[model samples]
Target chain A: MTDIKTLETASSPEKLNRVVIEPVTRVEGHGKVTLLLDDNNQVQQARLHIVEFRGFEKFIQGRPYWELPVLVQRLCGICPVSHHLAAAKAVDQLVGVDQLTPTAEKVRRLMHYGQTLQSHALHFFHLSSPDLLFGYDDAVAHRNIIGVLQDYPETAKQGVLLRKYGQEVIRLTAGKRIHGTGAIPGGVNKNLNQKEREFLLQDIDQMIEWGKTALELSISLFEKNLPNSRDFATNETNMLSLCREDGGLDIYHGGLRARRPDGSLIIDGIDYRDYEDYIHEQVKPWTYMKFPYLVAQGREEGTYRVGPLARINNCDFIDTPLAEKARLHFRAFADEGLVQSTLAYHWARMIELLHCTEAIRDLLNDPDISGTELITKGNMREKGIGVIEAPRGSLFHHYEIDEGGLVTRANLIVSTTNNNRAMNESIRRVAIDELNGRELTEPLLNQIEVAIRAYDPCLSCATHALGKMPLEVQLVDAEGHTVDRLYKNANGDVSLCKIEA
Target chain B: MIRHFTLDGKKIPFREGQTIMEAAQDAGIYIPHLCYNPEFVPHGSCRVCTVKANGRIVASCTTPATEEMQVENETEELQGNRRELLQMLFVEGNHVCPGCEKSGACQLQAVAYYTGMLAPEFTYFYPMRTVDSSHPDVAIDYNRCILCELCVRASRDEDGKNIFSIDGRGINTHLTVNSASGKLGDTDFDVHDKAAQVCPVGAILPKHEGYNIPIGQRLYDRKPISVVGDVADHQEE
Candidate 1:
């Protein structure tokens, strides 16, 4: 829950000064945090502004419907496979395919699990681990991956190997690691060959062990910090994700499930195609990104969280044994309610990583994965929608095609966009908690970034149009006098570069 | 005796009535081309095979090889011009290679690579184009059409069915089907027709059979187009 009383006192009607952190590092795309402060340096407001727009939705129009799967891969370099699969699922509907063959489904699942494994491993290990291992307040020079490598070589090596193993799974399943042409309109293009299966199996056990080790490391770090970690940037927001018919954690495909902070179901087992009936996007004037909320809850109370933390909170139970055990441990952190701490995202992400490894191992052993029956045909539909749980959160891709099989319109609500409001809330909470009546320093700036990094938002995937991002910081009083200033360019070079006239 | 022409300062022999491309192909020389298939009468719509003949620019596919003529095939200036032409072709239409099934096997992409055209210099037109998938087996994507007229020539001359034609002019010039409804589904075109298999780009394709071959194993993936030498021609019915 938000501290409305404290917020009201801090947020005076007087115009507050601003502190801008342009180009938050260790994340996917271009974004900045603007913290408004009063004359006493008390934080008044904070917002995560998405400064870049990639107009993928508009540009993809007029393309052939079948090309959507491949074309959407240009959306994000980090999670292109997620986009690839989601668009493929949507295209399947246009071609009239209600269901795919057993072989095709299994192959797609393998690819999705492999993608999740790689994406989760990337966020937890390479990007956010420095803040978790070396305290968030550590010197800027000593709080990077390089510093972690010099200090804890073994941990860094495990992170690299874990990410590499996931990438290998993607390469074998999709044909290429980055922009794979595996999943197609109605099904997958190919199946795992016997040789490919053998290769993946060679190190499947090692991957599982690494997953477990990573989960344990995250658990130890979170538990050691205890109350401090639990209280850091905590907020009570709704959670949303996909769950299997049996109510197990499902990343690839399932019915929609959203839960309130008090563990009450807002919506359950609803077909994701009807998501527009429940979810609506609210436009804000300040940023290009749109804020999505539950239509029933309206704008203010409707905003919710997604991604690992939300998925873990929303699922009834995880299917894998190891992951189920880890989930139970994670859920118990909040006792009678859902875990609302932003920092707990890393823990929940590791649990999913462990599950991905187990799922990959099981998929590799399945005989259906090698079967050649790959495609299916159905009655054509004019409109189609596909939704999946990407690494960041729930991703939706909807398209309308004319009789000629050409795309007339495209609407994509990416995972990062779903968390737009939640990210802003997290930043505001961190700013008020860490920066009130304090001197502005690099570590304080990093704390705000650490809160935003928890969601692992991809700004490039979130935006729907083109915009310029000018990076500069100025502390101006109510009288409009510049008290201080800082600047960061696109190349990440920081200096006292003067503002353009 | 065959007529002799010095191409790139090397003497090459050509028979009477043979064009410069024919002479190069017959003499074990490779000249990059898209609209000039050896099996068809020369239709020099795509000037990818342009060369310097006696210090004057000419389309080699249609230009007859002359005795004692100096023709420069692989000069730096010609290659540079060819790259610019390829870049123009790229930006003139929506030719997204990664999404197109013909990516690894596309001759246009290969020729661009052979000419060292790394990126399209011009802004993409992104013209609104229609895809005609009304046909049961074959589909045409107007966006990828490079106005080569290879399919038009192949259908009219070889298949004996004038099924496709170039309509409009300049940027509006587009491939149109000769049918009652302006659709391929209403046409007499068959999968085995010469026009169906003659598209040098991804303009025309067979349905339900795209991306079947893995990327690395496609026709142009294993070897550059300079070595493959129009192997995609007649490889399928």
Candidate 2:
């Protein structure tokens, strides 16, 4: 078991001097990290600022309840399946179906597994590998996928192949890999074909093996980069994920579970619709991202995390045999009941990947996966709520329909949005630790980025909106003035182009 | 006498007073369109079917087909313009195709496929269009409306209820119902009405049968927009 000790300090936002990394890179959305320092360059405040604005809430009014599933998925291409499924669950209540057909349920589950697998692979290889492989403080240009390829060509190929397998799973289950139209309001539009099944089945064993390989790789990373994995930032307050009644790793349909930093269950297996009873959202003026916390807990104190790390920590058991074994090893890493090291999120992701692949393999062997009955229709209702575990976190889609069954009001708490407070806190802590009153350098700035990246913070998805992101990090003085800025040039090098502006 | 016009290098014969769209349809060629339904009086609101004739752009559904016209229907330049028009439609409204029930059959999505425009080139407006689900059988999603006017024309000319009409100007132009309340249930627009059947987008949808047809088996999924007849020929009911 990993040793337990309080090896880090949290962020203290007191005075005004600031350092900023504008338009943060290697993350999904537009954001910046601002560090407030004292006169002696002592760290005071570190904040992750979300700059992009999207008014999805203002616009989606007056759409039909049945359209909610299709509309809300437009939030993020990276994890549209999560949004699509969550909204579909909400719409299912409006459609008046108590439960879906067995086949419909399995197909949806398959799609979810595919989504989780692909998204996890993407974070591990495409985004975070450069930092882990080349070292966070290495040359910015060499700390990316290209660098991974240059240093470890075979490893890069395996990453691409692993992602490709996941994509194929999506393409076979849904119509297209990204933004697929497979799941509808009541159930799904189609079921898997024998050919599609065979296509996935042929590669199932290989995928499981690759998943094991990936898991080993991730464990090695945590073992090697212990400081980066443990020390810099700790957003260990509380965690939330979905778990089955038996405490199995249930990603699609399950009750919500919330755990304390020690990994003891505060609440387990509660209906998702009751989320408001326990959690509340607090909006801050500095950023569009809202901080959701344990009800009445207040801002920083109420901070909790979602996503892979939380999911791994909160769950009691894994349903699948192989994944259960991997889960055991991951659990052993915890000194107490939870692993507070932000970098351990990468390890958590690999465990989920193993589970996803194993789950996919088992789901295929079941004959019911190809059933023809894909939808169930019933009397329409006026109000419905849907919740599902997205790759980033727990997602909720609630809609109120008129007598005509059209949506009058919609409120969505996306996965990333659930962790806004935690992400901000994590990035802040990382920034303060890496910058002990020194000038902002590429390596120091990257430490903060790695902290944010640990959450795989999908700001675009979290904002309930979507767009392209170009991020920059900067240094600021006492009166809130820009000292310097770091930008990613065309060659992927972090270039500080402008100064003293 | 046979009057011939070469469209995309194909000799397509046209009858007098017939628009380019009608001629192309008769010749088994699909010029991607959204608003120009054969049943309604041609209202070229959605310029998705715009074609270039003699170096000048014209709405194929409204412009009369003349003899021996050199029409550029399936060319790179015209298709590029059509892609932009589709992009404008996409960015202006909340046409979330992947989540839409009509995604597999939507004319906008189909034409987008036919034009090879994989994704929109502009920013999404993420309009907060309202959905009118107050009706018992049918629902109206304003976000998916391309302002094609097909619903308006069908409701007015065919159903004779005048339940729908054009309500705004310029980019603000929108579709509105004639009911005392803005809800669809308050209006006489039933699921069987031409207005409901005439929608080329997912804006107007039939309730309860959302995922009846599997996506890959849906109309546009099996055949491209170029092969299937226009929106009118592929009505769900």
CAPRI quality level assigned to candidate 1 from its DockQ score: acceptable
lDDT for each residue of candidate 2 in B25-127, tens digit (9 for 90 to 100):
9998888888888876788767888999877899999998888888998888888999999899899998766667887788889889999989888999887
Best by DockQ: 2
A1-501: candidate 1 lDDT, tens digit per residue: 336334423355358876778777778888887777877787777778899878888887766677788788779878888998899889888888979999999898888888888888878887898899988877555666777789989888888888888888878767788887888878987889999999999998999998999999999888888886797877789999988988999999999998989999999999998999999999878899999999999898998998999999988898889999999999998878799989999999999999999999999999999998999988778999999899999999999987767788989999999998888877777877788889777677888889888898887753222112334666666666676766644443446534343
Cα misplacement distance, residue B225 of candidate 1 (Å):
2.1
Residues A281-333 of candidate 2: C-alpha lDDT, one tens digit per residue? 88767777787887745565567888888888888788888778888888887
Pairs in steric clash, model 1: A96-A378, A96-A379
How good is the docking of model 2, by CAPRI class? medium
The TM-score between candidate 2 and the true structure equals 0.85
Runs of candidate 1 exceeding 4 Å displacement: A1-14, A462-472, A487-501, B1-16, B26-28, B52-58, B66-72, B75-77, B122-139, B159-161, B167-192, B207-210, B231-237
C-alpha displacement of B22 in model 2, angstroms? 6.2
**Per-model i-RMS:** 2.2, 2.4
Those runs of model 2 whose alpha carbons end farther than 4 Å from true positions after fitting are: A1-16, A225-228, A296-302, A462-472, A479-488, A494-501, B1-101, B108-131, B141-184, B208-214
